[model samples]
Target: MPKEDQNNLLFTLQHDFKTKLFLSYIDIKFKAVLINSSTSWYKLASYTIEEKNSVLSKIHLHLDDFVTIYEEDHEKSYAIIKGIF
Candidate 1:
């Protein structure tokens, strides 16, 4: 295989791993919120908007409720935001 092909493969794998890791992290965090057993939510959202928007965009923001949203192409829901943390 050519060097360029190898670089492309590496980039693809890195992107996949990052997406998976992120989904997993958010899943755990959502469960914690539903169970109302974590302060991490508050700590987690304290970051600046620029630093947080990408990951945050995957979910809906609520002051008194939990909300999970997704792109139109994403049929499955990641999290359901109902109860407050």
Candidate 2:
């Protein structure tokens, strides 16, 4: 897709869940996958995030696509990614 279209999608995703308290951040990861027939498909990208509270936030895009937010606690130290959509 065009850069502008991708940016607009990202912006829309951000706005959809800005009010939620649990979402810490959203990161986009793009990948290209090739099938046996040599056709390629662009994954919609992976959205990952860190949570600040116990509540699980629900994210929805204009297309009605959604991802559930959750927290992962480890003993090492402290870090967070607030949103992933």
Candidate 3:
């Protein structure tokens, strides 16, 4: 996606969730952590395979998609890619 589009997506992600995720697992385990507005980190581990696939498709979040990284808690973090719609 274009840089402008990517920025818009990132902005939406931040606005919706306030804080970004830290140390999310995009591997086979499909585990992820999300930080809330209060700065508390929580795990997102209950997503079923079918639900995950559906959300992934809706957001167009591909493995190869260029993501903006944030360095938090001394680890590389990323915004949970979600669609505005």
Candidate 4:
């Protein structure tokens, strides 16, 4: 590749990465699953908006409630909800 081509490729890569990083941090939606002790369990009948602590405020939790939160399009659940803040 020529010098101009290399510079263009670098710029494109950098721009793509920056856009992805910014989108990942902004307006992210999350899903919080409630863990039950028995074999039967289900998702909550509510929406969780991660912006401005809305998800944390709307959901009521108990000491025994084993809640696991997963980011949109992610398979792994976060260990703790407070870590999101």
Candidate 5:
């Protein structure tokens, strides 16, 4: 599929997130992060996948995405490559 199609597919993964994800911040362009209800934040793992680079790989987050945050992780979490929605 085209890059745009793949992005739309990944955006839909938001519903796949079991936890409550909120728009913590919005960077330039379509870049953004959805933070769970907890204070913890998960940076997007990466942008390009080594191969095939499926929607799952492009975002570095599977259907059920998760991460471990430090006590004061806060906005410092720079989950890059979890590209535009």
Candidate 6:
């Protein structure tokens, strides 16, 4: 959809995820967003928010758990927010 809609959807996921679990970090880039795993270090899911927002939105909305988000972009436009989760 539109960029604004995508942004709103992302915010919704972020809010819901934070309410359910303990998020480690969330980063938003250009191509995708990366969510840090709560248990393992190597466990992470890189999601393309713009493309998969619809599907992911539904999942995240219902499952309010800690899920780190990292946006995909050149030079890594995303960063981890420490002590926020």
Which candidate number maximizes TM-score? 1
Clashing residue pairs, candidate 2?
24-82, 25-82, 25-83, 26-83, 50-81
Please tell me which model should have the higher TM-score, number 1 or number 4.
Answer: 1
Model 5 scores worst on lDDT over the 10 consecutive residues at 18-27
Q: Write the per-residue lDDT of candidate 4 for residues 10-59, one digit (tens) a residue.
A: 67866665565456656464344333322322333345457675545355
Worst 10 residues of 6 by lDDT: 56-65
In candidate 2, position 50 carries an lDDT of 50
Root mean square deviation (Cα) for candidate 5: 14.4
- Point out where model 2 deviates above 4 Å: 22-85
Q: What is the TM-score of each candidate against the true structure?
A: 0.34, 0.25, 0.23, 0.32, 0.23, 0.28
Query: Which candidate has the highest lDDT of all?
Result: 1
Clashes of 3: 0
Predicted candidate 4, C-alpha RMSD: 17.9
After aligning candidate 1 to the native by TM-score, how far in Å is the CA of 56 from where it should be? 41
Q: After superposition, how far is residue 82 of candidate 5 from its true place, in Å?
A: 16
Would you give me the overall lDDT of model 6? 0.47
- Name the TM-score of candidate 4: 0.32
Worst 10 residues of 1 by lDDT: 34-43
Instruction: Give the root-mean-square deviation of each candidate in angstroms.
Output: 17.9, 14.0, 16.3, 17.9, 14.4, 17.2
lDDT of each: 0.52, 0.44, 0.48, 0.51, 0.47, 0.47
lDDT of 2 at 4: 100
Cα-based RMSD of candidate 6: 17.2
> lDDT of model 4 at residue 62?
37
* Tens digit per residue, CA lDDT, model 1, 26-79: 976865422222222231232334344464423335544544567689865556
lDDT of 3: 0.48
| Candidate 6 residue-wise lDDT, 5-52, digit = tens | 998996787667764543333232235445554423222334334444
Q: Deviation in angstroms for 6 in model 6?
A: 0.1
